[model samples]
Target: MTADPLRIGILNLMHDKVDTQLRFTKVLSEGPYNVDVQYFYPQTHYTSRPVPDLVQKISQPLDLKQVATMDAFIITGAPIEQLTFEEITYLDEIHQLIDVLVANNIPQLYVCWGAMAAANYLYDIPKFQLPEKIFGVFHNYLRAQDPLLKGLPDGFLAPHARYAELDIDKIMEDSRLVINAVTKNNFLFSFRAREKNQYFLFSHLEYGKDALLKEYLRERNANPGVEYIKPQNYFRDPLHMKDPEFSWETTQRVFFDNWLHSVADHIATQQFVKE
Candidate 1:
């Protein structure tokens, strides 16, 4: 018999949605599990213009009260990394999301800025601003064995576009968190909070083939005065840049498949315990 679809909640905080929906949907659908996704945007994120298509896909304003409706949830990185969490208009609402999702034992993934915010509110870990944007497709060394990194190389490449870094020392100090992945620069790339059944990933493993290149171009166009650097190891030819070489597509699919299966297992356990 076919299994019921896993219902996932997504909060697309990216201003330029582009292929966010496709990447997410495609990745999650890879494993044995099938999924149904519900998109949401915190109403307060309206300060920036929304992607027309993404805005239409959003099911409704985020509501923590309906936490029971989802088997898993995901929050993507936002462009507001330069601002403090409290300064964002949707702070309270997002906190509500973090609290309710955890309280109800929902398995979730928070990428980039969303991961940083969740780590902060949930564990008091701080985000450290970097002198320059950490924009690139970079390598990550596995710090420990994690199901999330199962099918990928022990040290793998993932895409990143951010102006800030997570407080590594503070996060390491949190006993509940297990460092899973790190970059050569020692920046924490991914970690698992075992108790919370949540994963905090600094890199955007779900990026489409040209996501980083697009981000680089957008930044350069917005501030012509600033000399934006091309993403590391991305260009087809460093001398005469062409299309970005696709790196993480297979690994990304593997990671999402693992996450989906894990969430299903966790939810099944939660339900089993209550019976």
Candidate 2:
């Protein structure tokens, strides 16, 4: 008998989590599995004020029970600062959630900050630290062929924006996670969760042109005391440079499609046994 479609639950932790969730859904839905995305937002902001009701309305907190019911779950990055992994307020909850997913053998994916969260939870590595904020389309080299990048080009670009970054050397030390892709600058990375058939990326694969623009503006407004100047000042005349043919949105969809296929294959094989 044929199995039911794979049900996916997305855990969005960022202020713009819903946007990323929707973009991911759009890409995954085009694949074989039935995609169902859910958003999760934190209660406090970097400044410790309650997130506005409008933003809160878009996402709800997720628990282990809720996560157990899904075939797969995805966690999005957030715009928060952490000197150390433990310093993050939601670190404990994220760790618990990851444990539950791993213990239950649930497939999962994490993007950007979500990647950092998984690395910290699984390897006890500190949060990524960077000398400057990374933004715009970044080039990454694929190490080996995996189902996740089945039909995509050999090299691709993804959107990025983060002051902190992970140490690739430390990530390499952890055998549980497999490094799928890396950048020449070593600022971006992608991985697959071997035990759970999950994936993680340290770039924004789901961000569209407008979404990137909004992020640029938000970063500009926040003025996080970083000396890095805004892209607008440098690329003022050719705004489309932000959304080149090798756009993050386009390449991200390819990555998302690969995830859907992995989920579909897992569901097909009846390998998703709940713990």
Candidate 3:
């Protein structure tokens, strides 16, 4: 008999709600297993302004009961990295969601700032502001082996577009955490706490070919007077650059394929024990 579809919940926290959802769905659909993807947003996120029509149409309120039904969960990064963690309005709800997911032993993936938030909240590792943003495709080397990195190469490229860096030393020191990948500059690329069934990825492996270019152009257009640097290792010709080389397509596909497989394996194990 065929198995049930894997239920995946994405807690959408990005400003570009539609585009963020598209990026995740595009990568996830390429996997072998059948998946039911749902989008959710923090209930406290829209207290000041009305919810956007597109967000309202695409997502539902982040109810804890609904979150418990998912086989796995993903929390996307937000643009509020500069703000103190306590200053974030929806953090209490996020913490509660994390509690529920942890209580249920559900697999969770936290991306970029979401990862930073998790590290801060769960492990007390803080994120530090950098002098300049790390806004480009960077090389990451495998630091340790895990099922999630099954098909990934020893060295691979992924996109990093953030202004803050997590405390690498603190993460490395944590006995419960496993450091999987890191850049030559010591930036933590990926890590996990196997006991908690939680994973963290600092780079944007799901970004589209022109994702960085579009962000660059939009930022420059919004601030015409400020000098902005083009994303490093992105353009074929720096002088006449319009498009980015989609070098990480293979990495993106294999990583998500491995992740889905991992989740499927977990589900099968649970079913076998119950039977």
* Cα RMSD to the true fold for all candidates: 2.2, 3.7, 1.4
Query: Between candidates 1 and 2, which one is better according to TM-score?
Result: 1
Residue pairs with colliding backbones in model 2 are 128-165
Clashes of 2: 1
- Of candidate 2, the 10-residue stretch with the lowest lDDT total is 228-237
CA lDDT for candidate 3: 0.87
TM-score of each: 0.92, 0.83, 0.96
Candidate 3 off by > 4 Å? none
- lDDT score for residue 72 of model 2: 84
Global Cα lDDT for candidate 1: 0.82
> Mind giving the per-residue lDDT tens digits that candidate 2 earns over 174-214?
77767787777766568775666667778777766666567
lDDT of 1 at 64: 73
Error of 2 at 238 (Å): 4.0
Displacement of residue 15 (Cα, Å) in model 1 is 1.5
**Could you tell which candidate, 1 or 3, scores higher by TM-score?**
3
Q: Report, for all candidates in order, the number of backbone clashes.
A: 0, 1, 0
